[model samples]
Target chain A: MQINSSMKKSFLFKSLVDYLYILNVGGFLLLLTTISFGFVEINVIKGGDEHWSLLAISISCISVLTCIVFLRGVYYLRKMARHLLTHKYFSKQIIKCLKISGTHFLLAGVMFVVIMILGWIGKLREGLFEFVYDINLMVPLFLMIIGLFFMIQSEALLVAKNFKEENELTV
Target chain B: MPIIINLDVMLAKRKIRSKELSERIGITTSNLSILKSGKAKAIRFSTLEAICKALECQPKDILEYRDS
Candidate 1:
């Protein structure tokens, strides 16, 4: 059958969604490798007759959990893109995915802040605060802002979806 | 929702089958079914005109308003 304009649009979206899925998978693999290597380094430090502190274990656990949440957000983004490709742009599934991803981003921002505060305290205890610039703290703040933006975008999508539904039903 | 479509009643009174009426009105059988089943959110004036002409009826004969 001959392809129409809408089918062509869906095809383009499908390609973009595939690219995003590849990038998400690559990033997730890199993150896992980094976490594994970091754990090895921590183990080496503990092997030098020093016990692993409770704080250190807690930080590692929190880091892994936060990463998982962030990855889940990426997964939702991929799902949303796939839904768009399938011409389900104004669906409940898309809205739910957006909201879930937004919430994950917000949670990741909070986790980043907590981790940064812990790092800052550790630096202060070692008299390293003098060398730490305010610029170093900007990342978490930026993430928080981005998270808020995602949340707002999700809300906007929800409203647009509602309007589209109403329009469709009006016919 | 209170504006009920009496399309099926009119069709019955006119002794017309849905498929024949839909064909005469240049609409699909499914669209006619939607109108008959009261599932259509809104009907176009052109479609209403076509339906009225095909059924040889007035607008009020095919539509009724009742308080919910």
Candidate 2:
């Protein structure tokens, strides 16, 4: 009983679910504001003699979509943390949340890569290939790696859940 | 699947109620019910011994094997 109480208290004290939920909401509001500002700025710039290129518009669209997907991954992660706080470590809902979060991360990474490739091609067309470096490509690669890691972790959790069920049913 | 619990039969034969048997064996009625229903995946030797002792029966009398 003492151990159970301590465990409950520890989860309550250590869980970042609430904080992440707040951050997700705040980040979403910030993203919305930023996108709105970008649209206004784009219109203002278009009113002048300089018009936005198709590549620039495509890049903005991809960037916004990637940010949305990343935010969704954060939301799912928050859900997983909430489940952990409830002592549901091996639940199906938690596993599904993890899987969804990982998929979102992967999708965000793919979108980021597409944006980067478009940017690179745009630069190459302007004869600026020498400025393109591997350092600029690291962030999307990292996101992909992190996404794969989470997917593998979710599979491990599924196996652990199966074992826990078997143990419980063994009386 | 072949292993079966005959706890209910022994309890009936000995005229021992499940609640009384559970109290004497220091186990919950739900757990005893699980045993009786043959839904328990495994039983500890201590629990089996306690059950046998409370029911006044041998292990063989409380358990049976049937070719399923």
Highest DockQ scorer: 2
Question: TM-scores of all models?
Answer: 0.69, 0.69
Q: What root-mean-square deviation over C-alphas does model 1 reach? A: 4.9
Q: Pick the candidate with the highest lDDT.
A: 2
**What is the per-residue lDDT of model 1 for residues B1-68, given as tens digits with 9 covering 90 to 100?**
89998988888899999999888988888878877888778788998899889888899998899999
DockQ of 1: 0.40
What are the lDDT figures for the candidates, one per model?
0.75, 0.80
DockQ (C-alpha based) per candidate is 0.40, 0.42
Q: How far is candidate 2 from the true structure (C-alpha RMSD, Å)?
A: 4.8
Candidate 1 collision pairs: none
Off by over 4 Å in 2: A1-31, A34-54, A130-136, B1-6, B23-26, B45-68
Which 10-residue window of candidate 1 chain A scores lowest in summed lDDT?
A: A40-49
- Please provide, for model 2 over A18-119, each residue's C-alpha lDDT reduced to its tens digit, 9 standing for 90 to 100: 676677778768768987787534442122437677877788878778888988887888777767676777899889988898898888888999988887
Write candidate 1's Cα lDDT for A19-136 as tens digits.
Answer: 7667867876886788778753455212253766556666677777777777777678778777866666668888788778778878887897787776666556556765456874
